[model samples]
Target: MNIKKNEKPQEEQLRKIYTPLWQNIFRGATENQDVDILNILKKVPIFSQLTKKELIKVSYIIYERKYATGEFLFKEGNPGSAVFIIKNGTVSIEKSNKLNIKDVYATLISGDFTGEISLIEDSERNANARCTTNTTVIIIFRHDLFDLIAREPLLGNKILKDLAAMVTKRLKEANEELVKYKLLAEVKNDH
Candidate 1:
């Protein structure tokens, strides 16, 4: 890069203006400390209903983590303790078949979320979540959720309601798929 005698470097210009005053307040907050969490959370359906203030409160309890390609986010039958929202890259949900082969149930992309059951209950995970590509995920642990609920009951209620709605919607879709598959099988049998 060539610069004239009177010209300031781009980095120097950015350093002077891009640093916000609030960044100083949150210094040393967390390993992946960044300001984009609220924007990310707003895109997730389960958190879409929350107001800006509620989302800001929730952001404090969330943490961001990265996974390399081929890393397992969580294995099936493992005890669940946190919910994950995909921030970047892809994740594959897989289950073991009778032949012991892993069959991919779904490929989730950015803006998709999983592990919600862990947030609401103590059941084991039902599927294996593996990173298909280098991925970034935002995690909300059960303990943090509990703390949020204790501090803000109304926000907690809204979150729970939204979560329930998402689960119900998924169940309905699964039921519809089952019906279609059953109808196809019956047709095949008739022929």
Candidate 2:
């Protein structure tokens, strides 16, 4: 690396620009920190099968942050970029109705993840996520995962497979719930 008379070190520049994001997320992933993160990821269903080594690779790209109650992790229509895993506290997923009132569709807790679609697609978030209490979340941006995949195809492929399976399962469950709701509406109208 060449140093210019007027320029600051690259590391310094990065630290200044991304300080908050890195402060908690990238503190070197020390032995104790690695075990702590590995334990959290292990509890998450999508990453359940990843080996210790694989999880360590994944951990390098993770960013963890804490939010106060009522803060939004993301808003509906925001460009989706990362998947978030709730490490503690609660987050509620909501959407606006025709009347513009936000209706919460789901409340997520520890070990649950959201925004998985962002990992594979460039799309807007369909719902909003707001913390219902002080919360800690682990975020993995799509670009980071893709870059890792480019360098480690086997690991990337495994993550992609797991993400796909998780999404498919959720879609199926949502479809079932929709059917049940439709049936209930029909029954109510018949009376």
- Candidate 1 residue-wise lDDT, 65-132, digit = tens: 99999998899999999988877777887788687977566666666677878887899999899999
In model 1, state the lDDT of residue 169: 68
lDDT (Cα, tens digit) per residue for candidate 2, span 4-105: 657555434333333332222212222232236678787665666788998899899999999999999999899999988777777888788787877566
Off by over 4 Å in 1: 1-35
Local distance difference test scores for all models? 0.75, 0.73
Query: TM-score for model 1?
Result: 0.75
Task: Highest lDDT: give the candidate number.
Answer: 1
**Candidate 1: 10-residue stretch with minimal lDDT:** 21-30
Provide TM-scores for the models: 0.75, 0.73
